[model samples]
Target: MMIKAIQLLVAVFGVLNLNGIECRKSRILNSFEYTAINCRVHSASIVDFGGVGDGKTDNTKAFQKAVNHLRQYASDGGAQLFVPAGKWLTGSFNLTSHFTLYLQRDALLLASQDVKTWPVVSPLPSYGHGRDAAGGRYISLIFGTNLTDVVITGANGTIDGQGVLWWQQFHKKKLKYTRPYLIEIMHSDKIQISNLTFVNSPSWNVHPVYSSNIIIQGITILAPVTSPNTDGINPDSCTNTRIEDTYIVSGDDCIAVKSGWDEYGIRYGMPTKHLIIRKLTCTSPYSAAIALGSEMSGGIQDVRAQDITAIHTESGVRIKTAIGRGGYVKNVYVKGMNLHTMKWVFWITGNYGSHADTHYDPKALPEIEGINFRDVVAENVTMAGRMQGISGDTFTGICISNVTIGMAKKGKKYPWGCEDVKGISSGVVPRPCNLLVDQGEGIVGMCDIPADSSAIDAMELKKCSYIG
Candidate 1:
């Protein structure tokens, strides 16, 4: 269902109720304002803390001091820090609880190029090691941990991460730690990051890990197409999150839904479940529009995505896993997608071939089931589908319906490459492989979106604003 102005807040998640009407519904999620954090009692500008926005001054201490001064009002109706219209050069700064950081229209937050500006933090317990190295990693530019009710919003302001040097260091293997992300919040709840432009990120644009009840909306992220690991949005081991009305052009996957790496993830047992993504526009020639994981050992379930648009992307959706990843991906539904200049329309692989360490158990097989895709249209496709599953542990319970794919002039002769996978397709163009046999009308209600009512159905966003 599409409304003229509505911002969804999912505290609990399962699936959307749009079945056959998924594609026909209107898309109008960008017309409204949704606030996860209410107005604060105290508000102060960065200049009040002796902050100079001269684009060369080190504003790290000023930012930290501003946050420290307003933190006392957390219980006294919270506080907000305002960044005026200027260039503020700063390093990594920790956010406080019950706080909001707002940037004016022309304001810019520039990440320092000095390595010392970034503090090193230990690797996530689930990841076991830094993604790019063996030891601790650099903290994000805007970081917070174990906090609640935080908002980082702006009036289309920009956050620029000077990442060319980091990219060069990574390519030369000179980095001893993982690159920093633009923004990251860990073990937090009721978080909102909206209405901002992020560019040239060293790594992921926004990363929410071990968090819940999060909302990310109306954001634009851009990076060089060849920049390594500059993912748009990554939600790791999170729950009940909603990402909507976002545009991204990146080197990596636009949205990478992850849990953790191999054995560490299984031991942590914190799955990323019950998430919703809608109204997304992505462009990444080398990566999928939305990827389900090469690091999902902690398991993933109840993910629903719809109203997606991709251009010059690798694939519309891809599920990646290996034998050592002993997690399960189930109850996933995607619908209402429009793709252009894609490689393969759909892809799933069990031979992802990347692991956290050598200590992983080879016998640990990931379970993939109950995946459904429908109401999609794609043009300029190279191949239709590349469905490869584990030899013995075949992926099952997949359903595709009401889809149309137009092949390019040099498209593959064999549009569908099937392996150890089985599914059913109805009303699909170019016909699927023998594994996914045509079901015609028999596929009715077989790929229905999972539906159940929880506290998320009852939750509604309240209107909030600031006068100062």
Candidate 2:
């Protein structure tokens, strides 16, 4: 059956190519690209299963029944769950493998605000405790585990998590478990989430953990600037992930790439690798636009980000780690970024002290190398870069070139601050700190952009449409 699906996809690709539609060979086409490929067309509407979309009815049971009825079609060439144009009020619901969840343009998936509706699950093995608490955690609104070929795409619908109560509880220290994410897929693969709008998540908006072969594109995620832990999208301990053409306004990092916490991560030993982030526009007054980690005890490598715009953000690109994080972050590259009104255009710290537990060894030092940034322009920057490394294990092989930053009128006394790190800078504004030696004019060769890489252009998806 899978072979048949592949053959159908190939035939449709041939047709599309013949019609002057260019498709790159570097990345696999998403479900929208192969809409003409016919497999088993087993589908059901949520409203047919007694789901009320009046914005007040509890559709949790309706959703469960619909999914349960559709699970049988997993082996019958997959199934699609269609959500019509209305407000769907539901609690947590599980997804099946080989399934597609499609929402119409006027549809809204409204999360139940009642705390009892959320289920409490055990902490991730890689992290012994919840990130915000000491025990279990609340499952996400749309939760799935160990599923394959799962897709959540639509005609730019909305998933609204009324998270004000959760935020209040967190601030008052009345929460027992960690707050839930908006959408979380764990231990799954071949996943695609696009053309959606996410708002007011309790914690992270979209989290894909311990998964691979994922694509997230053309989505908008928004949260209040003061909300706690409402990161836009966090790709945790995943491989072969691509995030592109997304806009984010969040209280935390727009795109935070994390693995596990200190000692737990070192033991899990699963690194997040081969990531591509491009064409992203972000705004966060108190957080970085793109943060590699404060939770990256597992190694992170081979990351490339380009063509990004950051406005009114705290920091542009941040790499955060501590002595207890016993992993290496290497081969990171960033280029073609535009920034405005930033506290610091770039920041890397070695003294971040957030920990899940006390079991992490204080002596386990982290390693950072091969960090490169080029072709960046910024304005109203207070400080250009503040890079701090541990005393013994200095961050090495850092390179910055072809970057121009205009400081604010009341900017910091020093534009750059560096300690315990060794690197070279060329054609950089404010003449980076003395720690970075002035390499000669021919230093452009130090920055390398990956050719033939799976960037946004390589994964351009067809605009999807839905009929209500």
Backbone steric clashes in candidate 2, count: 0
User: Residue 25's C-alpha lDDT in candidate 2?
Assistant: 31
lDDT of each residue in 247-311, candidate 2, tens digit only: 99999999999888899988998889989998999999999999989888888888899999999
lDDT of 2 at 370: 88
Alpha-carbon TM-score of each model against the true structure: 0.91, 0.90
What C-alpha lDDT does candidate 2 achieve relative to the native structure? Answer: 0.84
Q: Can you tell me which runs of candidate 1 are displaced by over 4 Å?
A: 1-34, 453-459
Full-model lDDT for every candidate:
0.86, 0.84
RMSD (Å) of each candidate, 1 decimal: 11.1, 8.7
Residue range 236-308, candidate 1, lDDT tens digits: 9998888889999999999999999999999998999888889999999999999999889999999889899
Residue 426 of model 1 has an lDDT of 92
